[model samples]
Target: MNTDVDRVVAHLDPGPGPGMTEGAHALMREIITAEPAPAPRPARRRRPVLRLALPGVALATAAFVALSWLLPTGPGFGPGPAAALDIREENGYYVVEVKDLYAGPDRYQEQLRGVGLDVTLRLTPSTPSMVGSIFPTSPTDHRYLDEIKTIDQPGACEKMGGCPIGVKVPVGFQGPAEITLGREAAPGEEYANVTSFDALGEPMHCVAFRGRTVAEVRELLAQRGLAVHEFRDTNPYIDEEAASRTSVPDSWYVNGGYLRAPGKANLNVSEQPEESDAGGLRNCAAPQGS
Candidate 1:
């Protein structure tokens, strides 16, 4: 039965129309070569009609031939490759929505390259205040830095804890730019950027330890269930070995400090009063010492 169908299909002229695609040809071959079901027992004497089945097979072949012309051929046959970044065009700018804050820099670079931008993305661990902020890392092109815009939902950073949702780059930008974005620090991980201990929402937001003795600052930290992890000197020329000492004199003055991690602080202390109070330390006028 299959041999008879094949002979009929071979004789049919599919000439003078659009050429069938490879896919359509394969489909036609499959339909012609398919096995027929076993003949059922007839109640009365009857002959099998091959002519009746030929019309239906021919119709199916014609339908598929039409469909093959519509099917896209060559390289872009199916859905394009998935992108790591969700970039869209808005107001003459390419708005890039950050889907994965923790994704590797290479994945982001590849996606940006697809959009004809030579940009490098780096995600750095930061404190709560600095999280979701974008910083330009390119030293040479200071002018182009202002063109890249950081986008954030209004009042999201302070109220909803959702900030810096994406970034906007001008269209036709041919940049060899490098940018760094802030991400939440992992457990026990130090922040890449400096976070003031007296900054709003910090552990020591209202604490007044400037010009206070090291012994006094230790007591202040002890009350708040925090400990000095290390001591840093503000002066760059200070001896590295002496500055990193585990123990310092209690009479040393506390200049400023920053939170290294949760419950751990790095105090900037110095022996001289003049040097300790050099930096602009926040003055808490209210009921002080948290």
Candidate 2:
């Protein structure tokens, strides 16, 4: 990572940072699979004094498992001061939520539809260069979102603690990030809360709260019975690195050029790309806080 940074800095003459760029941390890895320690040696022990306790403990374990299942189907999709937003479920599918930022709503709507999600848009009143956002393009889609934002943004929504459509700039946005709505929301259909959509978009951070929800956007893990992890307190998964605005390379640091001599070598064992991945040319996924 430092080597990459150095290359960028050399390309740009004036350093973007006084040197804090070097102070930046590495991105967290996809997941934390701590290296397993050696198996513990079995210690000699007498059998339990009472056999009756075995059945009771088993029953308790079963009940604990059952109760966990009855919990909400989605991840922690409620209001938070989370550094990152997450919508996860044990079964599959999730929602990503963010607040306060500029965007081309229409453009983003089309983009999602192109990826095949039956979109539920909630547009804001802000107008772009008059060209409109492009995430989705269906008229039905536009109509759907227009109605939702119009309704949710004005009136107070139940449980979410304010209007159904919360933005980063909105006040009183500290409650359920996602309030279950209708029958769909009954089992799990819900949205998440907002504090800021900034840090969630760091590069290498798979769970980001950028233009879309990361949890809902992933393909089925299909590992049935697996528990979903939505929140962790600072156990940095390092491969998931994010560059900061202060980290952005200055003209004196970042440089670009056409590929050299370009003699491509191909033996043909190309790996399949992820379908739901957010591959794009844009500013940092999340900008640093103001």
Instruction: Estimate the Cα RMSD of every predicted model relative to the unseen true structure.
Output: 31.9, 25.6
Clash pairs, candidate 1, are none
Best by TM-score: 1
Each model's lDDT comes to: 0.47, 0.18
The digit string of per-residue lDDT tens for model 1 on 1-290 reads 11222111111111211222333233334544422211111123221111101111000122222111011011211223554455656666765544555567677777677667777765555444445444332334332255666554344233111234455677776676666554555677654433456544345655767788889889988888789877766455766444544457899887777555567777777787654354335533353543
The deviation in Å at residue 12 for candidate 1 is 75
Model 1, position 136, has a per-residue lDDT of 35
Candidate 1 minimal-lDDT segment of 10 residues: 50-59
Reference-based lDDT, residue 70, model 1 = 14
Please report, as a residue range, the 10-residue window in candidate 2 with the lowest summed lDDT: 50-59
TM-score each candidate.
0.59, 0.16
lDDT of 2 by residue, 10-111 (tens): 000011111111111011111112111111111232111100000000001222321110111134444244212222233343333322122233543443
